[model samples]
Target: MGPFTFISRNSTRIIAGAALLGLVLPGLADALRPFLGYCVLTMLTVSMLRVDVASFFARVRRPLPAICAGLWLVVVFPLTLLCLAVLLGPPFALPLGLTIIFIFVAPPPIVSAPAFAMLMGLDGALVLAVTLIGTVVMPITAPTIASFFVAETMPISAVDLALRLALMISASFALAFLLRRLLGPGRVAAARPVLDTVSVVVAIIFALGAMDGVGARLLTDPGLTLGITVGSFAFALAQMALTYAVFRPFVGVDAVAMGYAAGNRNAGLVVAALGVTQIDDMVWLIFALSQLPIFFFPMILKPLGRRLVAAHSAVPNARSLP
Candidate 1:
């Protein structure tokens, strides 16, 4: 096999390795920070180019479940977190709590999600549908949610936030359509491995950029940084668990897919939308550490995913879509 094939096959390791490198080499983060938005747009463009539009819309036709999942991801999840913050008070009303809310307010990380779903033999189509829906609605939902919970903490005006998100999503979809028109869907589908490799490489660049200033923050206040990092991971796991439990009754392995979507938010989008330089250090740190679980936990969860896939396959008339 060629080098590209090898990298594609070993994407999980590449992702984990890239994330570790980012954590240790804070300088790369600073150097790459300026290009973070470009990287995010590129990754989104490539992933969108590869989307199976027919499959995506077929899932969307079943509007009840798809809308529910989308609402859960973009609206319900963040509101729930806001309620938690309200009930907990004190520290929960602080920057850390706002960071937690920001994570959920962000859309599903579509960059690697569909690829991860395919890798684990889960419902890639459903994952993509939920991701696309969540992303498309982010412009409307994200700013509204942010204003409700973190307006004081946010650096940008609500209108600016909405405009940035809309621009990002629109630009990505436009580029994707142009690419698809030029390359044709068959040609694009044939290059799945290449797309996956490119997505992973861009993700590594993003990971490095997101990690900017994290090391200094750690050095400045090791205890607080460590606490936030741990909390980030815990929040990620909690999202997954809560999503799985809530959606299991509707779909089996598909619930797992939703769980993955719920847990792996596009923090890059939120950061890019907000202007990373304008955000609080604590917010950046939380987003940075959140990447650890998003990239690493897939490897840890692969076995369970495989089992879930196998079990779901055995069920009579089992379908990934509700």
Candidate 2:
């Protein structure tokens, strides 16, 4: 089997990603200190280019599950996490709580969803739909959700966020259409591999950029830093668990599809928002650390998702008997 197959089927990728983050984290000054936001913008742009807008909205005939997942990410999950942070977490954890909530409120990651769909054997179209929908609705939904926790620092302006989102959607739609019309359906087959490689390189650069000033902050206030690290991880785990729970009843193809769509999100968008709002740098650190959960979830959950897909695939001609 190939490396991705082996890594996806086991927890190796997750462990490796976490280990790399840990090992490099202490020495991030050399890697992430200078180019954080610029790197983030590079990855975000690549992800935007990868979107297949036509395919995303074409399958809207069966959009209930996708819409529900969007609602959860943009609404229910954020509120619940905020409530949990306020009620149960340490008082100082407020910033981390806000950071976690912010991630759920942000638009979907442009690259990860497609990668996730392939890994878990989900319908790429479905994942794309959720990604499109989430990004479209983020401007309106995100500010509304973020308002609850950040009324002071940012005070939540839905109108401003919505305008920004509209520009992204319009640009993405135009690009996807232009490419589709120019290259036709078959082009995606060839384009995907190149895009995948580009996505990874861009993601690494973006991630490094986000870490730019973090080493100093991490060194200055290790306690707060530790809280963010732990809080972000816990929140990521909770979101993943919640996603699985919501889709468990639909085991098989739908289950895998839902799991992939639900689990993967555009967390980097939230990181961008943190920058735009000029919130505390600690908040950005929390969100950056939260990316670990996104990277690792497929590794942690793909085996179960694959097993479900296999079991379903085994029920030969179950849905198509002549």
Candidate 3:
């Protein structure tokens, strides 16, 4: 309990430290490699444990904003990227560009997006609600839209892909419900720090495990790997800024929360859904490199998030938020 509470209190340093560990110790990362799947499932379950069910359900009822956000992520943005690729043609580097664009169209936001938002002082319920809304719409929307662009590059049938998403998500949510019932909602609410600590521990393990070959890649292809790393940060930050800008007027302060959700998406979900034993190293590199922002952004943006959340709380007419 003491250690868990300490971890909860100092999660920012701990999480950033985890990223550093992954970069410095490739062997440790490889040892934990097999636990990546369990880490994800734990992240999803722990994320649900802290969410405000009432707020989640309210957003579920009035879901227009979530629907619009999902459309932007999976459909509109991908189409826009496709158009740009067509206009620019050869110099645009279609293969890499396609990989970049595929980030947005991948399943929902990360399972722990809500946890990240809450850690950064944003509204967790809003993020969770919007994310699940995206998930419900993903199976049909993702594969249909990706088919137009990805085609043979993905090499998976639409039906199997959808089923993979369903199974993983269903299992996580079911586990969440069972845990909640066993602990009782009141007890869980009272032990929030422990839950936060669980999220921190799992996230640390995840960051370490996901960086298996990234350090080696850095040694081998320093320039190219560095360039891709830069590109990954650009994609995450640019999408977050763009999403915040587009939705702020309509959703008010809640848009800030939406921006975090929009930018830090779950590209890994696409890999899991593809159901193949292996994929292209380049594609996998892009996906793995992408986790950097997702893991580190809460620490980086903590101050800005504090200001935004403070302003959101102060303004009465902020609209459509708890």
Tens digits of per-residue lDDT for model 2 on 1-322?
6553444344335444543464356565345434544444554454556656676666576677677766766677667667777777666246655555666545553446665666766567766666667777777777776666655555336556556556655665576567667776677655655655555555555555555445566678888877876776675555556675666554335545655554456666654544534645656566556566566666666687678678877875433101
For model 1, residues 1-322, the per-residue Cα lDDT tens digits are 9877888888888878877787689888889877888888898898899888898887878766667788998888788777788888888778567765765455665566877877777788888988888888889988888777777777787789999989998999999999899999898988887887888888888878878888888888899878977887888888888998898777766888888778788878878887767767666677788778888877887888888878877887654444
Better of 1 and 3 by TM-score: 1
Query: TM-score per candidate, in order?
Result: 0.92, 0.73, 0.87
Local distance difference test, per candidate? 0.80, 0.59, 0.75
Off by over 4 Å in 3: 91-96, 275-277, 309-322
RMSD per model, one decimal? 2.1, 5.4, 2.8
Name the regions of candidate 2 deviating beyond 4 angstroms.
Answer: 1-59, 83-96, 104-106, 216-227, 250-253, 274-277, 311-322
- When sorted by TM-score, best at the front, the candidate numbers are 1, 3, 2
Tens-place lDDT per residue, model 3, 73-110, is 76677677677776888645375566556644465788
The TM-score of candidate 1 is 0.92
Give the count of colliding residue pairs in each prediction.
0, 7, 0
Residue 226 in candidate 1, Cα distance off native in Å: 3.2
The 10-residue segment with the lowest total lDDT in model 1: 102-111
The alpha-carbon root-mean-square deviation between model 1 and the true structure, to one decimal in Å, is 2.1
Order of the predicted models by lDDT, top scorer first: 1, 3, 2
